[model samples]
Target: MAHIMITGGSSGIGLQIARLLVQRGERVSLLARDPAKLEAAKHALQSQYPDSRPVHIQAVDVTDGAALHAAVMDCVASQGAIDTLIASAGMIVPGSFLDQTAGDFNSQIDTNLIGVANAIRAVYPSMIAAGRGTITIISSGAALLGIPGYTAYCASKYGLRGLATALRLEAKPKGVSVCICFPPDTDTPQFRQEIAQRGPETKRFLGPPKPWPVETVAKHIVKGMDAGKGEIFFGFDMMMLDKLGPIIRPILEKAYERRNKKHIGAQEGR
Candidate 1:
């Protein structure tokens, strides 16, 4: 069984991905900031696989490079060299740029973009020395199209796309694979939190796009990693954004602006 380590495996998409991997009997290591959540995740997985599939967990903030590296080393000792690293740990705080604090903005960038980098860096040496491994970066739609009230979110995700592109070239020569998946808004705790913070302009601009269950997204992501895809995108909207976004983004933006005019007017009034 492949050893898959997910940076945000304690909750949301990360935990869901771990669940799927455990069900398939793959060994998993989960890293997150919350010890309680980590323990809960381990229990949930172990209970399901009472036959005792390996499910390891560590509590460490992804923003701390040294601590992250140490946790990776410890997991490597128990789980063997990581066969796959899913950099899925991420955070978001939705608000218009002017209204968002510098701390909030920087926090998202730290966890989403730099955190992903740290996770990859921690495992890359082992993978390169072993002459093989997969790294999957979990980006978002904001990576492709800027969403209203997600200035910071978009900045971080866009950086991930660039990182994935550049890293792909470097990894290919080392017999390692780097893949980035842009998932649409999925039903996750973080996304729900973001929804709660969005202004009406942001909400209206987003419209009523339905969220994919974490189960479906996790399944797709795992399959993509297995297939060694360079990039993975889901659903029709994402497909369009990936294949024809340059042609369509302007049109969509104009439409969104028109739809949310009233919301903007209200914000300006305030």
Candidate 2:
């Protein structure tokens, strides 16, 4: 059984991934900021896998590099050096660029981008010396293009793509592998919160297909990790965008232009 460490493992995709790994008899540890949530996740896992060892957990925010490193070491001492690291903790706030706060923008970068770096930095040396490991960064579809109300979120996730790209090159020769997943909107607490925060403008820009269930998203991510894929993308649309993002952006922009003009005409009763 491999020892897997997941940040943000108390809930959403992180927790679901842990469930899958545990079901397969892997040793798992969790890191998240909320003690109550972490404790609850631990109990839930233990209840499900009654025969397995207790999952180690730490209540620490990933944005704090030093604290996160210490938490990782604590898990390492308890379970073993983490053979797999999934950096899945992230947040998004939807609003027009002018309405987004400077603090919120900086927070997204720190938590999503720098936080990922910290998790990677904590485990990278050990993985390199051990000569084997996997690191999975959970980016988003927003990373590939500009979203109407996700300026900061897009920037942070895009940073993750770049982080994984460079790290993949450095890790391959050392027998460590890096994978980045671009999951489209997934139904989770975070997504619900995002929906609540979205303004009419934001909602107008987004419609149709609902978010994928968190279970499905987690399953795909785990399967990708199991297969050692360097990049994991769910859904045909996402795969298409990954292949044709640059080419497709212009088309989407024109559509957005037409949609905006129509909205303006309606507002003016023209």
- Candidate 1 residue spans exceeding 4 A from truth: 262-270
What is the C-alpha lDDT profile of model 2 across 1-270, one tens digit per residue? 899999989999999999998888899999999999999999999998998877999999999999999999899899988999999999887777899899998899999999999999999999999999999999998887787888889899999999999999999999999999999888988888888887766566666538999999999999898899999998888888889998988888777778888899999995
Model 1 per-residue lDDT tens digits across residues 1-270: 888999999989999999888998898999999999999999999998888577998899999999999999999899988999999999998887999999999999999999999999899998999999999999998898888889999999999999999999999999999999999889998878777777776777788758899999999998898787999999887888889988989998999877778666877999
Q: State in Å the error of residue 159, model 1.
A: 0.6
- The lDDT for every candidate, in the order shown, is 0.91, 0.91
Candidate No. with top TM-score: 2
Model 2 ranges with Cα > 4 A deviation? none
Worst 10 residues of 2 by lDDT: 200-209
Measured with C-alpha atoms, the lDDT of residue 167 in candidate 2 is 95
Per-candidate alpha-carbon RMSD to the true structure: 1.9, 1.1
